[model samples]
Target: MGVCTSQNEAEKIENSEQDYQKLDFNRVSTYQKLENIANNIAAQQQIDTIFSSLIQRMIASRQSHILDMLEKMDSKKKQQFMTKLERIDFEFIDSLFHHCYKQDYPDVFSCNVVQSINSQEQNLDLIKKHKVGIVFLCGGRSSRLYDKLLSDIGLPSKKCVVQIMMERLKKVIMIASDNQEIVDYPIAIVLSDQNSEKFQMYLKGKRDFGFQSITFIFEKSLPVIDMKGQVVFEQENQAVMTPEGTGTIFLQLNSFINKFPNMEYIHFLGLDNLAGLPLDPQMLNLICKQKGDALCKVIETNSILDDRIFYFAKQFQTIKDQAKGIQENSQNLGQMCLNDLYLSVSFLNTLKQNHEKALKLNQRYHTIRRGNNIQFEKHIQDIIEVTDITILHQTDDFALLIDDARKAVIQLSNVHKRNLKLEGTQEKDLVEITPQMSYCRREDLKKIENATYPLII
Candidate 1:
């Protein structure tokens, strides 16, 4: 088309209808694929009807060539991926496009009155009584962590992220158990398609790190759309796709909750944060004290970088325009990052009732470009509601993927065995003590020469 600015662009458009196996589908071949799927359905083969409706819509939309591309694949691959085809519901898309975030909700409540703990033993006791569960979110592309292959980046002690996290979990269990009978806690990870298989294989080659078992949650893939609102293809058959954001965890939240029948607390940790505690007693005290539904843990800071974590704590309905900056909250949330969330299991169940309705009410998409095509994605923070929320100040929380990953590593080294300065706070005596540090930047670890002080991490 005249819109193509380059040769590859023109070729991509041409290849869209003529690639391997010739995507140039006639009306007959399109119908044949439909019949094949229908025959499978008639034979009582289980299939998600979502895909059937989606493929039919593609045909009606005059882009039936996408189906031709699939038909060209060998029957074996075709059968295996029959359901992976992303479903596009036009009505949903229309609604999302016209949807406005106007639902006003409550702000985060801080429990400064709840006193801090004096030891890990206290934290352990809270864990035992509450029957807590941990859900780690690692379902990301990890595009920035590497330049090429995943194996390219080196790690400390020749250990990968999974190894470090697993070892830490083992340490936590040992400490919490305190030589008594082992207490089993539920641990779930929401994995992206890119890292799911790799992590499983990586774990297989190594030991379980200490826990007897873990739960793996896989996310669904959604298609990338063009400026014209059409799904873009990545290959002859595969369309460019990304994992449904953090909200995808809602899909498996019930199962994870089921793991701990007596669960009173659930902590959702972003795998990147090395400073967050696996079984923090402070978190335990806050949730119980607040009697909250969905609670987010926020650090108190005025650092410029903290702005990235500031999200709309609650949606305001009846307001025609969305506010550009965050409003002042009980705490300085505008300059605070959402470290993690601690929820009462009962409260979490309330969110698990209706996935579609919850997503429509909470999730919002943002347009961005990846290589050659544009994409619409929702942020994890968008789905989370700060209900009966409590802002717990974590002095030692550290998350990766900062503006400068390398610099963040340097800061870790400096704070290895020392205290860090609070950027904007009157409480000068309070310090973040790391009972354990679970992750490291490979290159930064290499830079440190033989040092005398203890690198508690």
Candidate 2:
């Protein structure tokens, strides 16, 4: 026992394991109380007031264990946690303790039924009638490639990933507008704080890419929790935080979407999806035709698929098993849904309203080790519970997911050999291509047949 710390508290805990077990700890009630206290403290402006209230609540609730833990931590660390108390979610942290330390798992729902769209032409016609916007999900920090976007085909150009995506979006906008010029088409980029500034800087004063209304929304970040469920600090006074799962975007973007009353559908795509053309006219037609609220494009995977690819896409099995209506197909390994999605603005509103129902669908938290700290992560796939979505299953993988530089090189090489039919003894990183080059269509590659290495198109 340290003389500087709570010696009496240490003696009580060490006296008997049974006494610790007997401590009611009623976690659910404790969490409710803590959540209330936290909300009250957060509303206050004064730091001293906040800390005093937090301490008083803990003592009043007879949460001696938490007090003991806080006492064991150095005064400076405690001060840091208390100072940043508003940013921390005590309920979430308490749940993490139940999951990580107590081996308690959240309920998982299984979906077994699969439904398909009957008429594509009908859906296409419906798409033309409704006004659609685009939701670009690219909230992740580029921790791997040292760049936010990378091209597999070595394209020598000043265009960044955002630029390339916008170029494609220009095509999408023209096509969606039937080759006529349109203005104020909504496009929102959901990104993390780490990359939001970089993206805004890159986009500032640049051409709108045929889009007048472009919104940049930052994803919510949560404090990192240690194994003991204590919040971790990155610096002397700064608490480490990671972006919450993609599902939280609805909460963040709901109010923003309300600003555009005419926007009916949201075409969701990932920034890293090099080949996924957003505002797809055909997909819009189909979803609108079916009168579906949401459309999710999932790739059917088998054991033959690469493990990295499997990990990259969230497993469709979780959806099939947990979600009630989806039926299973025994022929394939499982379906994997990338970020390529088309959702109705109405459904997004419904999802935002039923956020609690979405949370109850699954406890998809995974413990990730970042540097010296362990952080819990949640996923957006939880929204499947609330949304009535149409699944578009594809046999071949169309999403050219280029997350890192190494994957960019590998994917680029494959594209050259398969689509361009230009397999030669060339360095992988040296070959260059762009979306404007072929749009991943083989017929478009005819013009590039005679292209040489260090190829720039």
Candidate 3:
């Protein structure tokens, strides 16, 4: 009977312990959930504080639309946007408003713009005097050409535009070396971030097109702004962005000025145009003699030019007019303005001296249509608005522009046939002129004039 009583007492104690354990489990779970809810609320409050400050700044900067857009976004999107808003370059945006929206253009009228009077002998002499550097703007992609670097010459030679260009430079260097001592011309290529990796991979350890001095400036990208001036998102975390502009080339090159300390003038060339020779003696001479800050190559052509090409907004006066704007229609009746430029280092230095002004002045912003969003871009030619530029009016012979594959083939063939004196050759005829054979030397091409149809010289 005593044993039974003891067992009953132990059973009661065990049952009480089990009941306590069950109650403790419920207490812990409830506390855990409440703690998580409190933590989430705290996190949201912190996000609101930071983002509210950003929104206030946006409103202050006249970007209230951005705040409105933020208000309409769901919690997840709002969080994502706030994270990116922290990196928003408010200074660049403000500068855009300061120049573009306010119509605060550089005093282009004060700058001298004159037509070039060629003196080949004088120019050749000047070329020997001034140490010039070549800059290639390869930041743009050619969708129509099916290439990123515009490498294909649309020829059987298997030579690319860059190879041809470098060969031509070598030829020019050789010719210049005959008269005077010189160094291999410095080359600075400005490539966009998208193309830089692929291009650098192809060009790795190639000694930068076989030149001693080469500087690679990767163009920066700016965040894409929607039609409402809000940053556009490609994904939940990825923001859509575009390359800043050709203007950034100068901004970037300024930092690497020490690389080409001996270079007195910079000859800017677009990667696409093969007709214009780099640092052409004639243009170099004009830049040296006229004492002008900048020189622009202008062509008077009625032919349908590419949409990427620039146009003269007005007739050439004492002050050469800058381009009407970027992406003007081909039907616009005006001289075709090539972005190829010859600029004195002194002018670049002057820009550097006025760094703040230069930064704000050069960022010419325009809205590019991208579905519901807009992209902002700047042009190399916009520099003209800030400085005095000489307009070198070139003849139609200088206008072998390539906008598409067919046009490239036709234009390149025509140029080759005309130079080679291949009379019966049609535009569709595929001819290959190795850069080594002749770097656009008429006399050298004459030797291969009678070679053969579909010639590969």
Q: For residues 1-457, could you state the per-residue lDDT of candidate 1 as single tens digits?
A: 0122332432322223222233334755444444444333423333344456554445444445455555456655655556555445544443433342112222332222121222222345655553777877677666445411224122233334455556665566666666455445687877877678877776667754445577888876566556445567765466766665666566577887776788777777765554455656655665565455545655555454422234432221211113423233433333344647666776566655767746663554554455555544554554443233433333554644433444444444434423332233222122222334332322333333443232233
In model 1, which regions exceed 4 Å deviation? 1-56, 59-122, 147-158, 181-183, 235-237, 299-334, 351-386, 392-396, 402-404, 420-457
Q: Rank the candidates by TM-score, best first.
A: 2, 3, 1
Error of 1 at 166 (Å): 2.3
| Candidate 1 global lDDT | 0.50
- In Å, residue 374's CA in model 2 sits off its true spot by 3.7
Clashes of each: 6, 23, 1
lDDT of each: 0.50, 0.56, 0.60
Q: What local lDDT does model 3 show for residue 371?
A: 66
Clashing pairs in 3: 113-320
Structural similarity to truth (TM-score) of each candidate: 0.63, 0.70, 0.70
- Candidate 2 per-residue lDDT over residues 366-428, each given as its tens digit: 555555566665555445445555455452435354434446445555555556566554555
The weakest ten consecutive residues by lDDT in model 3 span 12-21
Better structure of 2 and 3 per lDDT:
3
- Ten residues in sequence with the least summed lDDT for candidate 2: 1-10
Candidate 2's TM-score:
0.70
